[model samples]
Target: MGIGEHVGRNLVTKSKWTSVANVQYRTRRAGQPFPTAGQLSTRLITEAKRTAERSWLGEVSAVVLQQSLRDAETAYRTFFASLKGTRKGPKLGAPRFKSRKDARQSIRFTANARWNITGSGRLNLPKIGAVKVKWSRALPTAPTSVTVIKDAAGRFFASFVIDTDPAADATRMPETHCTIGIDLGLTHFAVLSTGEKIDSPRFLRRAERKLKKAQRERPASRRDRRTGPRPA
Candidate 1:
């Protein structure tokens, strides 16, 4: 989890630097001065190497660090593409710097990181040592990559991306004749094609107090418009 925090911080720093550089380039009256992602990564990697030797970042896997930089590049690319109207999706928000107090943090490890699950079900992370993991289910095959995550509640999770056979997946689900489409609603949570209406649960109203408290505690900048005062 500490490693994840370190990586997350590095990503935010890199993004801020990129945004600043781009703004300066746009304001410059000289010849074309555009800072590309490759240029940014090259400089970032060099700086990271120098700093890594002296700080806790030295303990983080080099592969994981590079992956974080790649994730940042991807974010910038998507942001620019959205602005240009080339990307098909909801408007992408400019990548914001992450805070240490943020509720979630994550880092990815590729095959090069040499991570694996031990016979005892412990996850072997390079530099971080072996961590005991609770298996929800057995992985069908070895995963190509794994993302370690720490959530708001301070619980850690390892998400694995495994390549599976499509034929096996098809066989597992089998052909089903009883297929139904669901129309979702507020009062009736879901109305099935067979005319069965599942009523919305009362638990939402019961949990309103806790939800309201959580929203109230959130930073102003992070709070959405939905948290505002209700209509008269």
Candidate 2:
């Protein structure tokens, strides 16, 4: 996991540098500096290796670094599409540098990566040996790719995409005649199209006074911890 973190950090850092460089290059040219993802693949790979070879980054899996470049390309493509109004929904911000202090980190492993699940219920990853897996539920089918994630709570999870049969999915949810829309709001948990309203949980509102009282007494509690009780 440590090595994976190092790899992901370098990948994000290098990708951001390339994005900045691409912007600078565009300024010099007639707003047509670099080519699309396909044309720029070679250059990106060369630059990535050049940057990696200088430090501990060279130890990272080459395949993972390539995936990072692909992710960066996708980010740029999405940003451009949003700017041109080709994409739906709100406009997206340009790709920004990723920080280590961030709550989560993830790395993906494709088929090219020699990763698999062993009979012993362990995940066999490239470079990183077999790791025990805590099964929540068994996978229905083989996954095309797997993403290892480390969340803010310092827990690791492996998420994967699998192909499921449409018929099976349909069977799981029987068709219902009634249909309704819902509007979620702070005042009410949900307002249904059928005129039904679900009240919002007032737990926090009810406990506000107690919370404030606890906050007000917190300093005195700390003082009591530091000093002995006052004389009667």
CA error at residue 226 for candidate 1, angstroms: 29
Model 1 accuracy (lDDT, Cα): 0.74
Off by over 4 Å in 1: 1-42, 51-55, 89-93, 187-189, 195-232
Could you tell me which 10 consecutive residues in candidate 1 have the lowest summed lDDT? 52-61
TM-score against native, each model: 0.69, 0.65
Task: Name the TM-score of candidate 1.
Answer: 0.69
lDDT of 1 by residue, 1-232 (tens): 4555555655554555566556744675676555555565556554555774435445567677677667766776788789889999899887776666778778788999899888898998887778888889999878999998888767889999999998887887869888899999988999999999998888768678788999899877765568667444
Q: Tell me each candidate's RMSD, in Å, in order.
A: 8.0, 6.4
Q: Model 2 clash pairs?
A: none
**Worst lDDT 10-window in candidate 2:** 33-42
Q: Tens digits of per-residue lDDT for model 2 on 125-211?
A: 776778888999999888888888877656789998899999998888979999899999988999999999999988777778787
